[model samples]
Target: MITNETKENYNQCQNVNCSTTFVSHETVARYIIKPQLINVLIPNG
Candidate 1:
């Protein structure tokens, strides 16, 4: 039921700047997932 695909627009790790090294995964997940959850919860938008 799981697949490797991405439809959402997000800043990706290019390995050029290595910006992600400064941020924790939990923070990143919340940054991405929380917005999606809000949209799903408020579908009427």
Candidate 2:
């Protein structure tokens, strides 16, 4: 479920080697806010 009470959500993957916190250069990011978690689209590669 989603509620409209979130201040900040980090969808960045757990990839420590991701290089950057937020990468909007190549792939498209789809932000999804849930009850207790945030989801975002990331490149499969």
> What does candidate 1's lDDT look like per residue over 1-45, in tens digits?
122332333365778868453432222222444334344354675
Reference-based TM-score, model 2: 0.19
| lDDT tens per residue, model 2, 1-45 | 133432343357677888356533333255585357668889998
In the predicted model 1, the residue pairs found to clash are: none
Model 2 CA deviation exceeding 4 Å by range: 1-10, 19-45
Where does model 1 exceed 4 Å of error? 1-8, 16-45
Candidate with the greatest TM-score versus the true structure: 2
RMSD, one per candidate, in order: 10.8, 16.1
Evaluate model 1: give its TM-score: 0.14
For candidate 1, the C-alpha RMSD (Å) to the true structure equals 10.8
lDDT of 2 at 12: 76
